[model samples]
Each structure stands twice: as structure tokens, then as C-alpha cells.
Target: MHLKNALQKYPRLIVRALVHPTGIFQQIRQERAGTVLAYGLVIVLFNLIMTVLAAVSGLTPELMLPMAIASVLTVCIGIFWLHLFVYGLGGRNGVGTTCRVAVVGLTPTALLGWIPGVALVGFLWSVLLLYLGLQELQDLSKARAVLALVLVFGLPLLLLALLAAAPGFSVAWASPGRVTWV
Candidate 1:
């Protein structure tokens, strides 16, 4: 589907995905990979713009490029793990199909990311979408799908926490009363 159509359908699709995920998954499965990629690219660009805006608002230059790259890479890696988890959970959807679901599921967050204080909303919404997507696309029990998402997202977050606590490491943006240390 085109971006306009996708945007127009966002609210309805979110409701449908939550209420009847199988139908949503079927719709996502039928999406062309190129269209999904286009949608994803828009997210990446929007993320970059947000990063730049943050920099303008006093975020350090040293963190700018890395943040931009990381923002995009996070989405790419998220898609990869999404596909892996679906397969591991015995879903027969191909990689492209999984990617499409992820892209569409994340669409709201991706589009609204520029607004301050909205990232959390987008994130929570995307999590719900992913949870539903896994259950519907994989034909999995809710518990199993939740476990899959935990592995896909939780592990990395836990790892990052451990690594952050280790040695002298600190996330630059997280410095107390400072925009960055570097």
C-alpha cells in the first residue's frame, strides 16, 4: 500500500490489529517488501530529523552521528530479530513478511517520533502491536508470543544495562545534569 493509504488507515489498522490480529497479519503479509522498505526509510529519516532537533536543543555533537545511525540500525535489527523470533516460534511467514509486519506495526511510533514526549507512547503502542503480531502471525499462544518478544527486546536491554553498570561506562545522554560527558 502507498504511504498515504497506510497513514489514512493507521488508526483503524491499530484497532483491528489489537482486536483481530490474524486479519492484520494477513494484511501485513500481503504488503510488498518495497513498500515496507519505503515506509521504514521514512521512519529512519524522521529519526534523523529528531536527532538533529535534539542537537539543536543542546545535545552534544559527538553523540549526533552515532544517535542517527543507531536509531536507524535499531529498527533494522529489530526487524531481523522479529523474523528470527517468528521462525523460532514456528511461524511460517518469510523474512519479508515479518519485516512488513514490523514496519507497519511501528508506523505510528515512526511517524510521531518527532514530537517531544511522544516516544514513550509510540514505544508502548509498538510493543502492543508486536505482541499481537507475533501471536497472530505465528499462530502462537499469547504466552509463547510474549516470551518471543521478551527474548527479542528484553535480552538486549538487559545486556545494555549490565554493560552500562560495568567499568566506567555511562550513557552520554544519561549524565546527571549534563547533556553529555563528551
Candidate 2:
């Protein structure tokens, strides 16, 4: 009876919780997407500038190395953002949220020595947050809510990790010479 009343009163609560200002907080609580985009864009732009520098400087590899490093870092950041956007966060807050999530999620990739590990952690964190947000909308019990969060967020991350870590798994995209390792 209480459940029925709650559902009738909050008919659109679930939808509201997945969109706009009401849900925006849940969608973008961490600001991860923004950070990743900023870092990635700066790195890519810097690399483009350096490529021009290399050309004007007579095509020296030495001159290109720094730019190359910067570009690689940027791409890593972008990848992190992508991971978070796709796997960690889930909602219907529109394209702005989506883009922000994508960019921010990628920022961790820029760090050295712990790229994969950090990315994995970020991914997990994102999933957990998303799960919690969804559970809040569903009004489930604490234990069941946590379980729901795990199932909703965990399976996708597991699949993505597998794909990423798999041998011969490749995603091709074009970038400036400095951005491409091979």
C-alpha cells in the first residue's frame, strides 16, 4: 500500500532522477569528464603546434620527442575519459553530460607507471557512483541497492576490461603523428 502510494506520487521520479538539474548532480558529481577533456585538448593542441615546429625545425626526431610525449599523455587522458563516460556513468542528462563524462574519464591515462591500474580504478569508481544513483531512484533496500549497483555497473566494466586487456584488441582512430604510437 505504501509502495503503491509512493509510486503514484513519484510517477516521474525515476525519469526525473535520470535527467536535467534534478539528476545532473548524480550524473556529474565528480567532474571527471571536464578534467579529462581539458587535459586531452591541451595536449593535442600542444602536439599540433610542436608538429609545426618540427616541420620548420628541419624534421628532427629530437625536436619531436617532447611533443610526442605530450600527445601520448593527452591520448591517455582522452582514453580515461572515454572509459568513464561509457562505463562508469549512466544517465539521460543529455549530450553535454555525455561529452563531459567522456573527457574527464580519460584524464587518468596521462599519468605514468599506473595507467592501466588507475584507469581500472577510475572505471570502478564511476560504476559504483552510477549504481548508487540508480539505486536511489529505485528506492530499494540498502543491501539490494548495493547489489543492484554492483550488477548494473560491474558487468560492463568487466567486459570492457577484458576487451582492453585482450591481446590483439585494437581500436583505430586518426590523430596527429605524435598521438599514434605505431
Candidate 3:
């Protein structure tokens, strides 16, 4: 496929992922008050844990404040992204609902160090959601599902690897070449 044609097909693919035959607006209409309250509580708890961890990690007040802000932003963006993947892209209500619940339920793990263990859980969850979403794509053949999976997982990993490999990446320290603090 030509690059222009491939790029042109992407928006339709994304729209298919974002809007459902059931009507995206209607799904929002059907959400219950209790569900909203529960979601609110989850967000609050997730942010609280992240804030505490940031403070404990010795992040300066200035940095902690911004990190907390970033954490909240990440959660919000994750919600929207998952919503698009599960509801808009995936046709089955249960899969989308479960994925959303799983993402929110797992947010407390943000307090964990940014190591492979922590990152892996998030990565696996995303992969599972993509698999579920792919299963719902009536229009996509198996070859397309494989391509989608590559696009979904590969780009993020590539970017992460690039960032990690970038020059000047270093662990922050109070003193250079000294393990002990005064």
C-alpha cells in the first residue's frame, strides 16, 4: 500500500475504534450515578498514593507538585484512551468495561518505581485490551489484527527505548560520585 493511502486509512480505523454502532453518546447516557462516584473515588485514591510516593521519593516540593499534576493528567488521558479502545473501538460492552475497570483498579501501582516490573503490568494490560479490541473489529481480517497489534505495542516500546537510550540520561543524585549524604 502507498504511504498516503495507508495514512488515509488510519483515521477511519481510529474512528471505528472510537465510535460504535451502539452510539458513543448513548453509552455515556447510560452510565449510572454510582459508577461515576466509584470512578471519582478511584481517581482520588490513585492521585493520593502517587502524591505520597512522590514526597517519599525525595522529589523536591517544586518537582513533586508537577509530578502530581502529571500523574493526574496521565490518569485522565489513560481513561480517554481506554474508553476509545474498549467502547469506541471494541464492540463488546463487557470487554471495554472490564478493561476500564482494570486500568483504574491498577492505578495504585503508579507508586511503584519506574522499573520493568511496574511497566510490564501496564504494558500487559494494554496488550490484553488491544487483543480484546481486535476481537471486536468485524471489519479487520486476522492480518489487520496483527498489524494493529504491532502498531499498538511497537510504537510505545520504540519510543520508550529511544528515550532510555538518549544521551545524558542519569539517576538524579544529591551529590555526584558520593553514596552518603552529609
Candidate 4:
């Protein structure tokens, strides 16, 4: 197929994946690793563009490269951590399936994450997609999927939120290599 036709399918895949995660994940194992990597990179590109636009408005545009780097690193780390959790929860589908689900789950946040309040909604939707997709792709029970999601994302966010909300929160030793949390 031509590159244009292949590229066109991604937008449709994004919509279809969001609406029917189970259907998409059901066939995830049959998908090629190259195609999955391309899809993930496309979603990451969307996320990077949105992040850069948001930064350009009021935040530091100078941080664009760093942000892009961090975004890619985050996806890599997220995939590994999510796969770790899925494996712990008795998921035997290997990292490729988990990788596909992770990329598919990112569609909502990648598409609309720069919209301020809508960003939260998009993030929640993305989380939901991840949860559903994990269950389907890993063949895990609902409870196990919830546990994995909570462990991978929920607890860290809760801690971060709590720390951010605390009065007079400060990180004292933030010179370089190490830092303390709130």
C-alpha cells in the first residue's frame, strides 16, 4: 500500500480503537510489530505537537525539545511499567500486545490533551481505554485489570496530587541527580 493510504488509516484506527477497544485488541496479536510501532509514533507525534502548542502559548517554548524527549521516554517507560503490571497479573500475551494496547489507549489524550479542562476529560478517557484494552488484550479479569491500572497510574497520581495540594511543600535537594517528593 501507498504511504498516504497507510497514514489515512491511522485516524480511522484511532476512532475505532477508542469506540471498540475489545474489537481492536482482539486482533492485536495478529498485528505486525512495525505497524504497531508506527502507530505509537504517530500518536506520540500528535501528543508532542499538542504539547508544543500549549508551551508556545504561555509556557517556555525553549522546553520543546526537552518536552519531546521526555514524552518519548515517558511512552517507553509507560510501556515497560504497564507490561510489568500485566505480567504480574497473570497476563501471558507478551510485550507486543501490551504495547499495542498502550498506543491505542493514548489516542484520546494525544488528540485533545492541549485543551485545558478538556485535557482532564481526555486523560480520563485514555485511562479508561487502557483499562479496557488491558483486560481484553491480556485476558485478565476486571479486578486484575483495575489493580494493574491502579498500581501503574492511580497511586502515583494520587501521591502527586496530595503532595501538590499540601501546604508549604518543598524539594530541598534539587541540584541535579536526585530529588525529594512532596
Candidate 5:
């Protein structure tokens, strides 16, 4: 029922989800597990496409596979971490609900990620939507909601730092087919 409504209403929902997420918060709350997973898959596909395009534009094509893999992990695992952080901060939303909000909140990123300078607009847009979505969906105070948003956006940088600091960690493209990571 909710899925049918979401599918029928997705065109308008995407706009509301990106610009004024609170307007769509109730609709997202009505989503079930399958609908949420569908949203997740859409986000993942967007990330993959963006990464590939960035790679092809001479930004380390050799590392495209690793970058794509990392993006997927970040999307999936990061959502769980976000849920736990929100819960610990006294948020009452369930994991599924948070995941739904997160995925829907990423609509801007998915749509604008292909453009270089414009992509940053999508990133910042998603960040704002995620913050508002957290507040609305989790019934959180402003402070806790900001903290949750920080965790969601900051986790990627932390992971990158860890990977860069790992033992024998190095990546360089010596040539078209010769990439080194050691």
C-alpha cells in the first residue's frame, strides 16, 4: 500500500525529499522493508555511476573498483552505524525508519552527482536534508540531530583516513594498466 503510493508519488516525493524533507517525512515513515531496500539500491547505483564517471574523467581510473566497493560499504554499513548513534542519543526511530530517511535524503546526491562543481551542491543539499530528516523522523532535539548528521557525513572521512594509515597502504597509477597499492 505504502509502496504503491510511494511509486505513484515518487516524482513529487523526490522534489519534496530533496528541498523540504519534512514534507516527505511522513510518507517515508510509511515505507516498509522492501521499499526501503529499493531506495537503498537506488542510492548505491547512483554512487557507483558517479564514481565511474569521476574515474573516467582522469581521476584515478585504476582505483575505480576499490572506490566503488568503498562507496557501497559506506552506504550500507554507515546507515547501521547512524541508526545506532541516533538510538544511543535517545532517538525513538527504528533502524528501518532511519534507513528509509537516509536513503530518501540522498535523492539530491543521486540526481546531481554527475556534475563536478554542481555535485557539491548535491552533497550539501543531502546534508541539510539528512539533518532535517533526522530531527523529524527520530523525534530528536536539534543538538542530537546535528550529532547524528555529523556521524553520517563524517564517517566517510574517518574511514578514508584509516585506510590511508593502514600498514603498506599506498595507491598510485603508474600507467594505464599498471596500478600500485602497497
Candidate 6:
């Protein structure tokens, strides 16, 4: 029932996320956790399918099973990490606000990441949404929001770049017809 309802509502949500994120994020902030999280899962599942079928090898449950598990884990962990940074940086709101941002502010990423060349574009768009959502939805001060974003996203990326350059440690993506050594 919830899946059906979320799916039904997603068309509007997608347009809103793309066209006017601040308003939609404000709306999402008021949503219940279950519904928001369900929508997050749906987006992840849909993007995964699109990536697999449209850009990579055809639908393979074996690959999907682990990807699904990892994607869910990433979302859940990202929510907690975001909340920690948000609240620590003086966001008086509860974790639910951060959860909403993670769930809905990333809509473009979950929607457009399947396209081979546009994933980065979608990710940047999502980052902008997240920054706006932090202010509009959580009522975070500009400085705090910026700090939180840096802590949540910038720090990890910096760490990854450093790790990639470290001796005897490498990070690479595995794709169809290409085996990456890490």
C-alpha cells in the first residue's frame, strides 16, 4: 500500500525536486520517516535497474542482490552521518529532518545517475538541493549548513582522494568489459 502510494506520488515529487527543491524539501521535511525512506529505497531500486539495463550488463539478479544491499546500507549510513554532522553543527531539528534531506534532496542523483555521462551532473545537482534543503527545511544557519555539508560530504571525498593516492592502496570502478584492480 505504501509502495503504491509513494510510487503514485513520485511523479510530482520528481518534478518538484528538479524544478524547485526548496519547496519540495520543505514539504518532505514534514513527511513521516517510513514514507520518506520507502521513497528513497524506490529511487535506489529504480536507478539500479536503469543503470544495469541501460548502461551495463542486462538484468542480473546476482549483481543486483549485492548492489541493493550495498545501496540500502549506504543510504542508511549516510542518513546517520548527515544527522550527526547537522546536529553537531547546531541544527536544533531532530534527525528526521536530516533523514528527509538524505531521502529527497538526492532525487536527481537517484534519477539521473543511470545515464553514463550525467551522473556527476546529477550528483552536483543533488548537493545543491541538499544545501538548500538544510537551510529551508531544517532551518540551519548558513554557516552551520555549509559546515555540515563539508563534514558529511567533503571530508569523505578528501579522504577517498588521499586514500587513492596512498601507496599500495587504490580505488577504481568495475564496469562491463573492464576489470578494475584495487
Choose 3 or 5, whichever is better by TM-score.
5
Point out where model 4 deviates above 4 Å: 59-69, 158-182
- Sorting all predicted structures by TM-score, with the top scorer first, yields 6, 4, 5, 1, 3, 2
Each model's lDDT: 0.69, 0.44, 0.45, 0.79, 0.75, 0.78
| Tens-digit lDDT string for candidate 1 (20-76) | 655776776666667557656766677677767776787545455465577677778
Better of 1 and 4 by lDDT: 4
Q: Assess candidate 6 and give its lDDT.
A: 0.78
Error of 5 at 78 (Å): 0.9
Who wins the lDDT comparison?
4
On a 0 to 1 TM-score scale, where does candidate 1 land against the true structure? 0.71
RMSD of 4: 4.9
Q: Candidate 3: where is the Cα deviation over 4 Å?
A: 1-33, 36-43, 49-65, 87-89, 94-103, 110-154, 160-182
Off by over 4 Å in 2: 1-36, 43-90, 112-182
Better of 2 and 4 by TM-score: 4
Whose lDDT is higher: candidate 3's or candidate 4's?
Answer: 4
TM-score of 2: 0.27
Give residue 141's error in model 5 in angstroms. 0.8
Question: In lDDT terms, how accurate is model 1?
Answer: 0.69
Compose the digit string of candidate 2's lDDT tens values, residues 35-131. Answer: 4345446434544565556556756444345645565564455434433433334433444444443333232222221232343564454444333
Give the Å shift of residue 137 in candidate 1. Answer: 2.3
Q: By TM-score, how accurate is candidate 6?
A: 0.81
How does model 3 score by TM-score?
0.38
Work out the TM-score per prediction: 0.71, 0.27, 0.38, 0.78, 0.74, 0.81
In model 3, what is the error at residue 126, expressed in angstroms?
9.3
